[model samples]
Target: MNVYFHTFGCKANQYDTEVVRQAFADRGAVVVDDPARADLAVVNSCTVTHTSEAKLRTFVRRLARGGQGLETVVMGCAAALDDGTIVALPSVRAVVGGADPGAVLRAAGLPAEASLPFPLSATRSGGQGVRSRGWLKIQDGCDEHCTFCATTIARGANRSRPVAEIVAEARLLAAHHAELVLTGVHIGTYGRDRTSHDTRRTTLGELLEALVRAVPAVRFRLSSIEATEVDDPIARLLIEAPRHLAAHLHAPLQSGSDRVLHRMGRHWYTAATYRKRIEWLAERLPILGLGADLITGFPAETEADHRATVELVRALPFTYLHVFPFSVRPDAPAARLRDQLPPAPIRDRAAELRELGEAKATAYRAARRGARADGVVSGRQGGKVEVLTEDYLSVYLPTAGWDLRPRFEVTVD
Candidate 1:
C-alpha cells in the first residue's frame, strides 16, 4: 500500500504525523511524496484556528478529486473534537481522534495487534526521508485553559514522555539529522506531569541537559515555549552552550494588555512580567532569534488595549512575529464572550502588527550580514544550498565543495 500524509498547523502536529508515518512504514506500506500516487492518505489536522480546519477540509476534498481511489484517515486535534463534519467529507474512510499512532494504525485498517510503540523511531531523519533536521516530541496536551484556545478541549491535559524514552529517540534522530527540534503542545510544561521519585529531569531545562549530554553532536532547538518558564538551567545552556542549544526562543505573547490577557485566561504572567523575562534573555544573548505569537482584536478588546500591545512589541527586540486576527471557534470560550470585535478592526490591527514585525525582521537580518554563524544545510534553492543559522536566519551558500557535516559554520551575507 502507498500512503501519503498531510499535516496542518504546528511542529507538534508535524511530529505526530512522523510517528504515524513511521508506523505505516514499519508495516511495509510505501510512503509516497504526492497524494496522487497513494492508495491511502493520512491527514493530521489542527484546530488552532477556524481557518486551519477549513484548509484541512479543502485539502482533503482536493485529494478526493484526484480520483486515485485514495482513502483518507483524518486524525489529530480537529478529528478529536469533530462533530461528524470531518468524517462526512468524501473519500474519508475513518476518523481517529487525538495524536495516537496506535489509534491511527487501527483506523488505517490494521488490527489492534499491528500497532507499534506509541512513539516509534523513524527509519530516516524525518517523515519523508533523510533531512537536515527532525522534530522530537517530548510531551503532548496542554494543562492551561486559555479562553481563545480549543487546544485544551481537543488534546486534554499535559502528559509527558519519560526522560529515557525521549533520550533514546533523540539519539536515533541525531544519527541522521543535524538538529532536533523539541516539539510539543506545551513544551514549557514538560515533566510537570511526572510524579516519580527521580526529579533530576522534571523540568525542560533538565531535560535539555540530559539531551545535550546524550547527543552532543546534534544541535537542539526548542519549537515554542512560554516566557515565564525559561528556568535557570535552560538559561545557562543558552548562555554557555551555543553549539548544543541554538540561541533562539519563540515565547508567545498572545496579548500585551493585562486586561486583554486576563480576559483570555492567560494567568501565567502579566505584560510587565513578560517584558522583564524576555528583556533579560535578550540582554544575555547578543544575537537571539526572538519571536512571539500575538492575537489582535480579541473579544471586548479596546483601542487602548491594541495600543498597549503595539507599545510592548515595539519596546522589545523581536526578530519576527506571528500576528493572528482572532477567529471565533464555536467550542472555544472566547466565542461565547460579549463585545467581540468586528472584522474590520481585526484585519486592521493584524496588518499594523505584521508591518511592525516585518520591519523588525528586516532590521535583524541586515544587522547579521557578514557575521559568522553556526548553521545546518537545510535544502537547495536556485542552485544554492540554504544554510539555516542558529539564530534562525537563512543564508544561502554555494553547493560546491560542501563538507556535508551535521553542522556548518557560514558567513551571513
Candidate 2:
C-alpha cells in the first residue's frame, strides 16, 4: 500500500509519527510523500486547542476529497480526545487513541510483528538519509492536572525510559544526525516514577551526564521543561561542558500573576521563583537562548492580571515567546469556569505579546552578528541549508548539499 503520513502537533507527536511510519514501511507498505499518490493517509494529530482540532478536521476533509480515493486514519492525541465528532466523520477509516505506539496497525486490522524492525536504524527520508535532528522521546504523559490542560488526560501519567535504552538509541541516531533533541511531555520529571518504584533510579540530570559520555560527538538540546526543574546540576552543564549541552533552555511561564497561576493549576513555581531560576540560568549562560510560553486571557483574567503578565515579560530576558491566547478545551476546568474572555480581546492581547516576542527574537539574532556557532547542518532551504547553532539559532548558508557532515561550523552574522 502506498501511504502518506500527515503529522500535526509538537515534537513529541512528530517523533511518534516517525516511529509509526517506520513500522508501516517494515511491513512492505510503500511510504509516499504526496497524499495524491497514496492509498492510505494517516494523520498523527494534536488537539491542544479548539483551533488545532478545526485544522485537523479541515485537513482530513481535504485528504478524503483529494481524488486519490485514499483511506484516512487519525492517530495520537487528537484521536485520544475520543471525540465522537472526529470518529463519526465519514472520511475517517480508523482512529487510534492514546500513546500506544502501535495503535494505528491495530486500528487498521494489520499484523504488527516484532521481527520487522524499522528498515533503517538512522533517520531516513525517501529511503535515503536526510539532514535532520534526531529526537529522543525519553518520556511521555503528564502528572500535572492544570485547569486549562487536556494533554494530561490524553497522555496519562508519566513513565520514563531507562537511561541505558536512551543511550543506545542516541548512539544509533548519532550515526546519521550530529545533534539529537531530548524531548518529552514533561522531561524535567524524568526519573520520578522509576525512583518511586526503585531506589537505584537516575534523574534527568544523571541521564544527561550518561548521554554526553556515551555519544561524545553529538550535541543535545532539551525540549520545554518546567522552570523549577532548572536545578544547579542542569545549570552547571553550561559552565562545565558547553559543547555537549546546548545553551538554550525553554521554560514555560503560563502566567505571571500568582493568583492566575494558582487558578490555572500550576504548582511547580511562583512568578518570583520562575524569575529567580531563569535569572540564575542567564547569569551562567549569558547568550542562553531563552524562551517561554504565555497565555494572555484566561477565565477571570482582569486588566491587572494581564498587566502583571506583560510586565513580567518585559522583566524577563526572553529571546522568544510562544504566546497562546487562552484556549478553553472541553472537559478542562478552565472551560467550565466563569468569565471566559471573548475572542476579540483574547486575540488583541495575544497580538501584543507576539509583537514583544518578535522584537526580542530580532534582538537575539542581531546579538550573534559575528559569533561562531557550531552544529551539523540540520535542514536544507531553497538555496541555503539550515545549520542550527548551539544556542538554537537557525543559521542559513548560501551553499550546501543535503547531507552535510557533523561539525559544519557557520559564522552567524
Candidate 3:
C-alpha cells in the first residue's frame, strides 16, 4: 500500500507525521507525495484557529474527490477536539485523537505497534526528501493554566522525554546533516515531570547544554519558550553558545497589560521584565532575531489596554510578530467572559498589529544589509540559490559554482 501524509499546524504535529510515516514504511507501505497515487491519505490536522479548521475541511474535500479510491484518516488536535464534525464528513474514514497517532495507522490497516522503540528517530536519510528542517520533540503537553488556551486540554499534563533519549536523537539528526529544532507544547517545562527526588530536576537550559555537548555539529533552534522561562541561564547560553545554536528566540507575550494577563491565568514576569530580557538577548547575540506572539481584542481589553499593547510592541526590539485575535474555545474560561470585544474591533486590532509586524520584519531585514552570515544553501530559485541562516533569515545568492547543500559564510550586501 502507498500512503500520503498531510501535516497541518505546529512543528510538533509535523514531527508526529514523520513518526507515523516511518511506521508505515516499516510495515512495507510506500510513501507517495501525490494523494492520487496513494492507497491512503492521512491528514494530521491543526485547530489553532477557525481558519485552520476551514483549511483542513477544504483539503479533505479536495482529497476525497481526487482520491476516490483511497481511505482518509483524520487525526490531531483539531480532530480530537471536534471529532464529530470531521468524522461526519463524507471523505473521512476514521478519526483518531492526537495523543494516539499509532491507532490511526492501525485503523487504516497499517501495523499496530504499541510504540516505536525511539519515537524521535527519522527514517529518511541523506536529506534528499521534502523535509529540510527537522523538529525534535524534547517535551510534550503543558501544565500552565491559561484560561484562553485549549492546548492543555488537547495535550494533557506535562510530559518530558528523557534527556538521554533527546541526546541520542540529536546525534542522529546531526549525522543526517539536518538542523534540529527543539519543539514541544510547552518546551520550557522540560524536565519538570521527569525529576528525581535525589537530584534537582534538569531544566531546559541543562537539556540544551546536554544537546550541544552530544551533537556539537548540529544547528539547534528552539520552537518557542514562555516569557517566564526566558531566565538568565538560558539567555546567557543563547547569547554565548557556539555558532550552531540558533540566534533566534520566540517568546509569547499574550497581552501587555497586567490585568489582562492575570485574567488569562498566565503567570509570567511583568511586561517591564519581559522587555529587559529581550534587550539583554539582542545585545549579546550576533545577528539576533527576536519574535513574539500577541493576542489582540481579548475580553475586557479596554481601549487604554489596547493602546498600551501597541506602544509596548512598537517600543520592543522584536524582528517579527505572530498576531492572533482571541478566539473563545468551547470549554475555556474566557468563553464565558461578559465583556468580550465585538468582532469588528477584534478584526481591526489584528489587522493593525499585522501591519506593524510587517514593518518591523522589513526593518530587521534591512539591518542585515552589508553584514556577513553563515547559511545552508537549500535549493535553487530563479537562477539563484536560496539559503537560510541559523536565525531563520532567508537569503538569495547568485547560483555561480555554489554547492547546493554547502554551508557558506556569505556577505549580505
Each model's lDDT comes to 0.89, 0.81, 0.79
Ranking by lDDT: 1, 2, 3
List runs of model 2 lying over 4 Å from the truth. 113-129, 196-198, 400-403
Worst 10 residues of 1 by lDDT: 121-130
Q: Give the number of the best model, judged by lDDT.
A: 1
Point out where model 1 deviates above 4 Å. 112-115, 126-130, 197-201
Model 2 lDDT-worst window of ten: 114-123
TM-score of 1: 0.96
Candidates 1 and 2 compared: the better one by lDDT is: 1
**What TM-score does model 3 achieve against the real structure?**
0.94
Model 3 root-mean-square deviation: 2.1
Number of the top TM-score candidate: 1
lDDT of 2 by residue, 1-413 (tens): 88888878888887888777777776788988788999888898887887889899889888888836788889888798866888876568888885454668766566865343433233555463454577888889989999998888888899898787788888888877777888889999998888654468778888898999899888888888888897667777766787888888889998889989999999888999999988877776767888898988888888888888888888888889999998889867799988899988888889989998899889988988788877567766578877788877887776545345656767887
Error of 1 at 370 (Å): 0.9
